[model samples]
Target: MNLRRILAGGTATIFATTALVACSSSDSEDGEGPIRIGTTDASKSAWTVFEEQAEARDIDLEVVNFGDYSTPNQALSQDELDVNLFQHLKFLAEYNVGSDDDLTPVGASEIVPLALFWKDKDSLDGIEGESIALPNDPSNQGRAINVLVQAGLITLKTPGLITPTPADIDEEASKVSIIPVDAAQTTVAYGEGTPAIINNSFLDRAGIDPNTAVFEDDPESEEAEPYINVFVTKAEDAEDPRVAELVELWHSEEVQNAVATDSAGTSVPVERNAAELQEILDRLEEAERNA
Candidate 1:
């Protein structure tokens, strides 16, 4: 895959155009060819579930792996993939604004909570002026700030919201020096020195023990609502019959059990009302536009 085009520009322009072109071209050749799924390279358990579910459905499922958070949504918007299952509504909304992509979420997936890990300290208060690494992606960076605020280590002017940037920090109560790093490198940042707020998948990839972390986002908290990962497709095809079928399959007893067992509580299935889900997505999109 061409990584350069995938990584170019703001989320609205580059990704949206790519998604539009890809989807338009693919739609002409074969609408029912296969269910092409896009996802990040970080989550192993989700990949397993995708494979198992596809096999059971006897449907051809192609998994396109992306190195960064931006590409998957771009590919999905362009119809390069039938669906993508890697990002939360917050990230999706940011991409929509940054790229002007009209993507829509069809299914709710796991919640891989953001966690703050320290190589030197066991408590948040012990770390003063320590360099803290965060995901460079807008959504996760905001999440890291929220995690810090939750730990009482910092204060965000807008708490319990998505895509909050460094500029959003109140500064009065915020002390730690925040460092933005690539999502994949945040785990390594922790090992290099200073504490880092690593996403769940990266932490797992780096073999970091979650118990050693001084703080973690509360999975059940209201702050986590925007971060609930989803399976998304283009807005036009959002309510397609196949899309509903696929979502039902994912929420099935067998699949849910598999996800729960495989992720070991890291990926939980959320029961959300349809209107409520749309409201959350709308709020995120509004936030992204206003940002």
Candidate 2:
């Protein structure tokens, strides 16, 4: 996560611009200041519900949208955002490692599982030597490979390992040509040709039907752990009264129902205890260190 390099990368330029605006507006704890939140545009519904909840609590809520995955953590680290709700523990850990920032998750949100979609085929075996598009980001690229392994389309040297990369691809089946493209471009690639795996967000944005996806990430499996989006803030802010209040609100029945009905299953709020969330975060942090 070279912030400069990532910013220079066109994928997240919109997020960077929004972060600049947020930083400019966050000069004081003035009565006029809103609790600025950084998140991807795909999670618009959750942000709407969060804004409503914040308003009900008399807290001004400002929602900032990011185009790429890297900018939210960067914005949060720079205090441009009070919090972010776009990435999972794995991505957060990677951000922490790359930026040396101490951010912590306050609550878990949806599990937007990655799916392998193809316009021409129903199964991986059926489309041999087919061109596949995958997210170029390291975390997602590795996760997509794991999905391929899970589907028995390919095998990794170590199964059940977190963040396995292409270097770890052991059994290379001749039919599959795993191509790395920008995560945001995966859906577009599908329209142009066959894509082996596309992030759920990209697929949804492209209007691809999830039910018709050729291969989907197993939401119930450990491999999908890295894709579970969560609300995150500075570690020191994790226990702040306001943070706790918002986390509780996000998990409330009202918000849960809103997510289910409004998101059309794009987001699945985690219904885990505080202790369990901590355990998951801790495990993911450890995995990131090893990776």
Q: What stretches of model 2 exceed 4 Å from their correct place?
A: 1-36, 57-60, 64-71, 78-81, 120-131, 172-177, 192-195, 252-254, 257-264, 273-275
Q: How much lDDT does each candidate structure score?
A: 0.71, 0.68
Candidate 2 CA-lDDT value: 0.68
lDDT of candidate 1 over 132-216, digit per residue (tens): 8899886678778888887777777876656578888877777777888999988888888768988766666788876677888
For candidate 1, the 10 contiguous residues with the lowest summed lDDT are: 1-10
- Prediction-by-prediction clash tally: 9, 1
Off by over 4 Å in 1: 1-33, 41-45, 59-75, 120-131, 158-161, 175-189, 253-265
lDDT of 2 by residue, 229-278 (tens): 67788776676565566677788776777776655565556655445656
- In model 2, residue pairs whose N, Cα or C atoms come closer than 3 Å (at least 3 residues apart or on different chains), thus clashing, are 129-175
Error of 1 at 269 (Å): 2.6
